[model samples]
Every structure is written in structure tokens, then in C-alpha cells.
Target: MLVHHLYSGGKDSSLAAWVLTRLGYEVELVTVTFGLLDNWRFARETAKRLGFKHRVLKLPVEVLESAVETAIRDGHPNNAIQFIHEKALEALASMPDVVRVSDGTRRDDRVPFLDLPKARSLEDRFNVAYIRPLLGLGYKTIRELTERLFIVEIRESEELQKADYEVELRHLLRERGIDPLEIFPKRHYQSRVLGWKSL
Candidate 1:
């Protein structure tokens, strides 16, 4: 009954984990890091606030390097970001006790999404369930739910220290003297979960 939720300490993923718990599954917030930064701590903190068990998984650094190269070659981070997400899902599915893996992919999200083919492939290859609690929910509904259920802090992606892949990707890009803003979109807002709102 334990489900590993790909958590980024953001509203959508946080809400997704919460919804999974409501549906009678024990949710564990799993944050993936590339060892490029310590931003995973932010996710651990939010997981504590939600009272969910949390752990950090370190992915191969070569994978992150490849993502950075893809972003540079494509002049954007969409596919590169998606690449990391898919890899993360695969990693979670391959874990010893991971029978079900979940992510916060929403209806309107373009990047970091699992298409039908990929989801089916993962489930088939690993004999695991690919769950997306927020897949059927749009941005508006997700926002409303988060507003009612939790306290959230919103800011520009560059300023926010959430545990999403973009943060590490951007950091690697900056270390290579390539400005992340050159590839990432302008005015992208990211949210961080602070605590729950009591009814």
C-alpha cells in the first residue's frame, strides 16, 4: 500500500501525494537529486510538514551531464527536462520495493510528462503502476485545491529553491558559463509548499 511519490516540494506534486494518501495509499515523498546541489533538503522539509516519509535518491551524474548537453544542443530545456523526468520515473520503478510510482504531472503540463506509451512501457517492463493523481486536474483546479489544503510560497523559478530538475539543470548550465535564462523561459513561476492549512 506504500506508493513512492516523485516529490519536488511544489504545490502540484505535494497535492498529488496528499491525494494519494486520501485514496488509502501510504505515500512516501521521494526526491531525486543529481548531487549537483542540496536543494533536495527543501523537499525533505515540505515532506516533514506533510507528515510523509521522505528520502533522497541520487541519480548518475552522467545523466545530468547529458541533459545539459541536450539543452544546449536544442536551444531549450523542454525535451531535456522531459528526459530527466522519464529517467527518474524509470529509476523509481526499478527500485527494490517500488511497486507503484507517481508523479505530479498535470493536464496542462508540457514538460516532465509521461505519455501513454512511456507509462505503459514502464509499467510493462517493471511490473509497476504508474500513477498520476493530478493528471486529470487542470491548473485552476490544482491551484484551488492547494490553496485550500496547504500554505504555498510562489516566486520566479530562478529565485525559488525547490527540488525540481530544472533547478539542477540551471545550476549546471550556469557552472558551464551558459546562462540558464537564455534557454529557459522568462517569467516562469515556481511554488514551494510551506505547510498545511487547517480547516
Candidate 2:
């Protein structure tokens, strides 16, 4: 029974794994490499530091680009990110050692996105858990938890460059003048896409 954490090698995702470990779940970190993530060292180091298993799932940049490009070609350019997240989830769920998939989604983040059920939709029929221990806690709180646990060192990223999807979407969001929340669907964070409650 391999428990997987939705790791982005960023503060939020890393914090999610940290919190879950304290809660007594057997957690491993999964880093979905989308773009030029020159190195996968962060996931490896963080997992080793926290004593959790880590794996890198390399998503083909071409296929990912094709999906987004197709959605754009179909006239829903703005929804590219939504498709990207969906793509990531589809790929993430296929791995063998993933009994549970956990993410760094937060309490403050839930109200807008209502992501609980979104996470659970990836669950396998075999009873895998999609966990989110930081569902109600904000970025600040997650950071606090990290600091309290003396894991702040994980936040330092030495990446040579940012992920392309991250850069492009942020630019689009800026151009649209919509908060990132607008891009996030306000859906449940579990198996059933029940309407979300702002926690």
C-alpha cells in the first residue's frame, strides 16, 4: 500500500506531505515533471530528509502541450490550466505504488476552488485514499508548520528556471485580471464532485 503525496517541490505541496506524515500515514512524494525542471533533486532530497519515499513521474511535454494546444484550438484557451491539471491527474493515477494521493491544497484555498473532491476523483476503485491534511490551513500556516518542524530548508528551490506551464498561465491570469482562484473550479475534493464548502 503505497501512499503518494502530490508533490510540486514547492512550499505548499511539500508542506502537505509534512503534515500528513505527522498524522501517521505512510506517505511517498510524487513529483510530476511538466517542463524544464532541470533537476528532480528537490523531491529526492525532501523525501529523504523527511524519510518518505519519492518518485518522479515525467509527463511528456509534447502530449501536455498538445492537450493544452488542442483546448486552445477548440476556443477555450483560458481553460488550458484546467486541462493541464486534469492531464496531470490522469497520469498520476496510473502509477503502481500509489494507494493514496495527497496534495498540498489548503483550507483558505478550498473556499474558492473547493478542491477536496477534485483530489478524490483520482482515487482508484481499489480503495486508494486521496489525502489533504492541509485542506483548511493557509500557505502561512503550512509554512508555520514547516518551521515548527524545522523543515523550512525544503522551501529553498535552486531550479534553473520556472516550469513553462506555470509561467504561461500566470501571465494569462495577469492579463485577464482574474485571481488564480477564478481558474480553479469550486468543486468537491473527494470521489464525488459535490459542491464545495469554503472552509
> For this target, which candidate reaches the highest TM-score against the unseen true structure?
1
lDDT of 2 by residue, 129-151 (tens): 66667777766766565555543
**Which segments of candidate 2 are over 4 A away from where they belong?**
35-37, 66-79, 110-117, 124-127, 150-199
Model 2 residue 169 distance off true place after TM-score fit, in angstroms? 8.0
Question: With candidate 2 superimposed using the best TM-score fit, by how many Å does residue 87's alpha carbon deviate from the native?
Answer: 2.3
Compose the digit string of candidate 1's lDDT tens values, residues 1-199. 9999999999999999999988999999999999979999999999998899999989998999999999999999999999999899999999999999999999998998878998899999999999999988998999899999999999999999799999999999999999999999989999999999997
Itemize residue pairs with steric clashes in candidate 1: none
Worst 10 residues of 2 by lDDT: 188-197
Which parts of model 1 have CA positions greater than 4 angstroms off?
Answer: none
TM-scores for all candidates: the values are 0.98, 0.62
Report the lDDT of model 2 for residue 118.
60
Instruction: Pick out the ten consecutive residues of candidate 1 with the lowest summed lDDT.
Output: 110-119
